[model samples]
Target: ARATVRNARALAQALHDRGFDVLAADLGFTRSHTLAVRVEREGGGESVAQRLAAVGVIANKNLLPGDTSPKHPGGIRIGTPEVTRLGMGEREMVRVAEILDDLLHRGKPPEAVAAEVAELKAGFTTLRYCFAAGEAAYRYYDLVGRDPP
Candidate 1:
């Protein structure tokens, strides 16, 4: 829980620095793992979410003020729970923001961004806040039937 809050705060700052209009900036960006971004100018929330997902940055389309339909909202909701569980910190958040900026503003290809995302993800395979520290979160199917290595 603590790591989630810390990483979420870092992500909010990174997103703000990369020119995304982060909501509730006056309230220190966010209190939980979720951060809301207004993406009405670049595209609607749904489109932006799809673009991000295509580049391996998963996010959800969300409704902001003046938005009535779920299909076409005005904001994108990003969260750090999974990454935090993977033990990412502020630096990773900044990297993620850069990836988003490249994909969203600089017109980078999704495959290119996905390469970077994969590299970043490779370093954090062990999950945190569950099991023993440093234990692998997922076990291989072949190994599952055997004794612990």
Candidate 2:
């Protein structure tokens, strides 16, 4: 829980520093494993979420003030549990923020960012904070199909 929240806060701060409208930033962004980025543009949440997915960075479309329907929202929620469990720390959050800013803010191609995302994932192949020390994260998922013990 501590690492999750810490990573979330770090990610939020980094995103915010990169000119993103991170929700509840004044209140330390959040105290949970998640943080929200409000993308109050024409396409908004769904659009941003899809773009991130194309770059191999997963995020969920979230409703915000301008959102009129669940299918179309104005925010994207990013969670930290998976990365945290993969032994990522605040430093990695900085790199994540760079990817987001490049893709979303600078209009970088998803293909270009996908390579960066894949490289980052490859660096953290083991699980931490859960499972036995030195356990393989992806293999554990493959063995269980879902849920972790």
Candidate 3:
């Protein structure tokens, strides 16, 4: 729980530092393992979420304050439990933020960002505290799933 919160806070701060407009700056970004980011400039939550997904970042678009519809949200919610379970810490959170910045703010190509994301994901394929590690976890990158042991 502690680690999850720590990483989530780190991620929120990093995202904010990149001028991403992370929600809840007064509440320390988040107290749990998740945070919300408003992407009004990048075409709202739904569009930005889809762009992030194109580069392999998994996040859900949800309606923010004053937003009327869930289908077209104004914010994207991100969580850190999966990466934290894979042994990611504050440093990796910063890396995640950098990737987001590059894609969202710096105008990097989706293909390039996808390769960078794949590289970052490759480092965490081996999950800690698990006997089967990569085999046990869902292969979210290439969609290659193992049947069973």
- Give all candidates' CA lDDT scores: 0.86, 0.87, 0.87
Q: Which stretches of candidate 1 lie over 4 Å from their true place?
A: 140-149
> How many steric clashes does model 3 contain?
0
Stretches > 4 Å off in candidate 3: 130-136, 139-149
Q: What is the alpha-carbon lDDT for the whole of candidate 3?
A: 0.87
Q: Report the lDDT of model 2 for residue 117.
A: 90
By TM-score, the best candidate is 2
RMSD of 1: 4.0
Instruction: In candidate 2, list every pair of residues with a backbone clash.
Output: none
lDDT of 3 by residue, 14-92 (tens): 9999998888999899999999999988889988998999889999987899888877889999999888888889999
Instruction: Pull out the clashing pairs in model 1.
Output: none
lDDT of 1 by residue, 1-149 (tens): 87888888998999899898999999999999899999998698989998888767889999997888877899999999888887899899999999988888888888999999989988988877666657775555346675422
Q: Which consecutive 10 residues in model 2 have the weakest lDDT in total?
A: 140-149
Superposition error at 126 for model 2 (Å) = 0.2
Q: Count the backbone clashes (under 3 Å) in each candidate.
A: 0, 0, 0
